[model samples]
Target: MAKKPYSNEADYVIVGAGSAGCALAGRLAEAGKQVILIEAGGPDTSIMFKRPGMITMIHSEPKLKKKFDWGYYLSPQEHVNNRRLVATRGKVMGGSGSVNGMIYVRGNKENFDSWEAEGNKGWGYADVLKSYKRMEDWQGPDSELRGKGGPIKVLENPDICDAAKTFIEAGASALGVPVNPDYNGASQDGMHVIQENTSNAIRFSSSRGYLTEQELPTLEVQQRGTVSRVVIEGSRATGVEVIEEGGQRRIVKARTEVILAAGAFGSPQILMLSGIGPAEHLRGHGIDVVADLPVGDNLHDHLFMPMTFAMDNSPHHSSAFYFGKALLKDRFKPGSNFLAHSVFEAGAFLHTSLSQSTAPDMQLFAIPWSYPPFQDDPVRLSPDKRPSLSAFSTLIRPKSRGTVRLASADPLAAPIIDPKLLSEPDDLKVLLEGVEMIRAIMADSAIAKHVKEEYEPGPGYTGDKLRAEVIKRVSTVYHPVGSVRMGVDERAVVDPELKVRGIDGLRVADASIMPTIIGGNTNAPSMMIGDMAGAIVLGTGL
Candidate 1:
C-alpha cells in the first residue's frame, strides 16, 4: 500500500466512474464546474476491453476478468433449482459499461413514462428524451428522434452475416413480429439489428468517451480509489471517505452535492455502509444511523433462458487466427467490422399471450456461436462443433424483487446480493410463455429450413418438464437496477430530482435510482440519468 497526496475537495464529488458517473462528471465539468470522479477499479488497460470479440472472454476467461470484475456470486436461488449464479459487475473506470456487451438500447418510451407515473415527475418519455439525444452521437440512418454530434458514438454494425439476415426475416414472416430496422425508433415491437457503443470497431465506453476528453484542469479522475462511506454531517452528506491503493484514506468534499453513481448493487451497499439504510439493519451492523431509508430494497433485474438449435450451413466463421492478423494491421472501417460487435446482433420483442401488458414483456435475441449450457442441464451445446444458433427468451419486466444487504460492517467486504430470482410465480409463468413463443418461431417453415435439431425442451418436454428446464437454465442478462429507488413514497431512496429523501446535499444518479427496471438494456438509460441528473443538480438544461 503505497501513498500519494489526494485532492481534498471539488465542487461535485461523484463516486463510481460507471455509466452515470462518466456522463455526470463530463457534463458538470463541461459546464465549467470542478468535478472529482472516483472508481474502485484500476485503469482500463486490457486490450480485451477494446475488442468486442474478447469482451465476453471476460465472462469465460478468468485471468482477463480478474483485473476489473468484482466477481460477486449470489446466494442460491430456490426457484431456479437452488443454484448460485455468479454476479458479473465491472469494477473498471467506465464501470459495467467498460466490460458489458455494448448493445445500446434506450428502452421503450413507455418505460420512462411509467417512472413518472410512479410519482417521479419529469422522467416521462418526452422529458427524458433530451438527455439521451444529448448524449448519443447517432451514426446510423437517423430521423428527428435520434441525436447527432454527442460524445458517445451510437453506431449500428454495418456488417451482418447471412445467418443474421435469416434471423431478422424469420421474426417477421414466422413469429408475426414485424421487421423493424431500428428498434430505438418509433416503435419497439419488432426485431432489428442492435446499435452498439462503438466507432471504427473500437469500443466506446463511458470512461473513454466521457472522461477521455475531459482533460480540463477542473476535472480530476482517481482510479483504484474505493469509497468507504459517504461522510454525513448531521442529516446532510458533505463528502466521501476514499481508500486509495495501499491503505491510504482521503476525505474528498463536495461543495454542491455528493452524488452516488455506483450502480444498483454498489450504491445500496455504500448507503448501508454509510448508515443510511433501514434503522434496525444499521444497528445490527453496529453503526449509528445517519438517515434510515430503504436503500437496498426493490432490487430486480432481467433474466434470460437460452435455447440453442443446430443450424444448416451458416455464412459465418470464428477464425481467431485470421482476425489476429487483421487486428495487427489495424484495418477496419467504422461500423463495418463484424469482430467489433457482439454476436447478439439481432433481437425481437413481443407481448406474451398470457400477459395483458401493452408493452412487450418478453425479449428475444440470437447468438450465432454455441455457448455451453448454463449449469449443465443437458442443453447439448457444441461450442466448437457444427454451427448452432442460440436464441435467448428473456423476461425484461420482472415481478420478482430482491435485496442487497451488508454481509458485515467492513467496507471492503462484498455485500450479500440475493436477486431472489423466480421468487414470484408470475415471473415463471411469463418465462414459460416466452419459451413457448421461441419454440413456435423455431418451428416456423422459414426458420425451420435452417434448424437441424431441437437442443432442449424438445418434443418430450411439456408442462412440468419444460417448467423444470426453465428454472434450471434461466440466468441473469447482467442488467441489475432499482436498489436505491426513486419516488415520492416513504420508502423511496431519492426524490424526483434525485435528492436523497432523508439527507441534504446528497443525491443518487445511476441505474440504482430506477423505480422499476427498464424493459431493455440499461447501459444507455444509466448514462441518460447521469446526464439529466447533472443538469438538474446544476439547475440548468442541456
Candidate 2:
C-alpha cells in the first residue's frame, strides 16, 4: 500500500466518505470549518464506476465485484429456504453511490411525514423537501416540485430501451395507472421513467459532486483507513481510533464533533465495536458499555424477486457489440453509450391490496437485458447470452426485522447480519401479490407480442408451486436501512437531531438513522440525510 502523511486533527472528523459523509464534509468545509473525511476503501478509479452499463457486469463477476464492494452475506434466513443472501455495498470513495444502479428517487412524501408523526420534529415531508431541493440540480421536465441548480446532478434517463418503454405502457394499462413522466414530481405512483444522478453519461457520485467538484480548502479526505472505534471520554466523543492502510494505528482528534456516516451496516457495527449498544450484548463481548440503547435492532430491507422473459425480437442497442462500443467511448463522450443511464431505467410504485398506509406498498423495475439467475453456491453469475427482458417485483415495506451484531470485536471483521427476510407471513403474502401483478402485465397483448417464453418461474407454474418458487427466488434489492434508527423513543440510538442519546459531540448521518425504511432506492435518501446534517451542524436553515 502506498503511504501519505495523514492528518491527526481537525475541527470535525467524519467516519466513512460515503454519500452522507461527502456531503456533510463539503458543507462544513464550505462554512470554513476544517473537516477530515475517512474512508475504509481506496480511491474510486475503476472504469466500472463511471460507465453505467458496467454495473450489471460488476454484479455478475465476483473478482470484479470485490474490487470495490464489501460483499457481505446475511445469516441464513429460515423462511426463505434458509438461504444466506448476498449483500453488496460499495467500499470505494463514493461508497454505494459509486457502484449502485444510479436510480434517483426521493421515496414517497408520506415516508417523511410519518417520521414527524412518530415524534421526530422538523422531519416531515415539507421540512425534508427543502433539503432535497437544496442539494439537487434536476434536469428533468420543469416542475415546481423539482429543484434546478444544486450540487447533485439529476437528469431524466435518455436511453430508455424499447422493451422497457413497452413494459411501462403495458403495466400502466393493466394496473389502470397513467404513464407518469416524472415519478419524483406530483406523486410517486404509476408507471414512470426514473432519473439518475449523472452528468452527461458518467455517474456523479457524492464524491464527484460534493468533494471533487466543490472548492473547499478546509476539507481533507483520508482514504483506505478503517475506523476501529469512536474515542469517547466523559460521555463525549472526541475523536476516532483508525487503522491505516500500512497497518499503523493512530488517533485522529476532532475538536468540535465526530460523525458516523458508514451506512446502515457499518454505523451500528462501529457503535457496537465502540461498546455503545445493548448492555448484555456489549458485556458478553467483554467491552465496557457507553450507552445501553438498541443500536442494532430494527434491521429491515426491501425484498425483490425478478421475472424474466426471452424476447422474440431483439431489443435495439442491447447487443454485445453495442455494449463493447459504448464502454470504449462512454468515458470520453457521455451520452454516446447506449447504456448511458442506469440499466434499470424505468419503474413503478403501486399500492397492494394489503397496503396499510397512504403510500404504495410495492415498487417494480424494468430491465431490458437478462441477468444471471440467483444461486447461493459460488455466488458468482455468468450473463445469459439470450435476448431477454426482466421485471422486478419489490416489497418496499416489510414487517420482518432482524439485527446486526459483532462477529467478533475486530474492526476489520465482517458483522453478523441477520435480516430475517420473509419472517413475517404478511411480507411473503405481499411479495407474492407483486409477482402475480407482473405476470398479469406480461400476459397482456401489448407486451406478450415480444415474449418468446417465460424464463425463470416457467409458464406452467401455479398455486402452491408458484408460492414455493417465490420462496426459492426471493432476494434483497440491496436497499437496507433502519439499523441505527433515530427517534424520541427509548430504543432509539440517535435522537431527532442525529445526536447519540448519551454521547455528546457525536452524531449519525446516513441510512442507518432512517426511523423507518423509505419506499424507494436508498442512495438519494441517504444523501438527503447528509445534507440535513450539514444544516443542523451549521445552524443554517434549508
Report the number of the highest-TM-score candidate. Answer: 2
C-alpha lDDT of candidate 2 relative to the true structure: 0.86
lDDT of 2 by residue, 1-542 (tens): 88678889999999998888888998899999999999998887666777666776666566767877887998999898999888888898999998889889998999999999999998899988898888899987677788878899998887787787788888988888888888888788899887889886678888888888889999989988999999999899999999987789999999999999998899999999898998898898888899998998999999888887887654634445667776677657766755577888678999899998889999999887775567553245544567888788899989999999988888889999998998899998898898889988888877889888888777777888988988998888888898999999886999889999999999999999988899999999988999899999999877
Against the reference, the lDDT scores of all candidates come to 0.82, 0.86
Model 2 misplaced stretches (Cα beyond 4 Å): 1-4, 313-325, 329-334, 375-379
Error in Å for residue 216 of model 2: 1.0
Top lDDT: which candidate number? 2
**Would you estimate the TM-scores of all the predictions?**
0.94, 0.96
Tens-digit lDDT track of model 1 for 376-437 = 32122235445777778889999999999999999889999888999989888888887877
lDDT of 2 at 466: 82
Shift of residue 70 alpha carbon in model 2, Å: 1.4
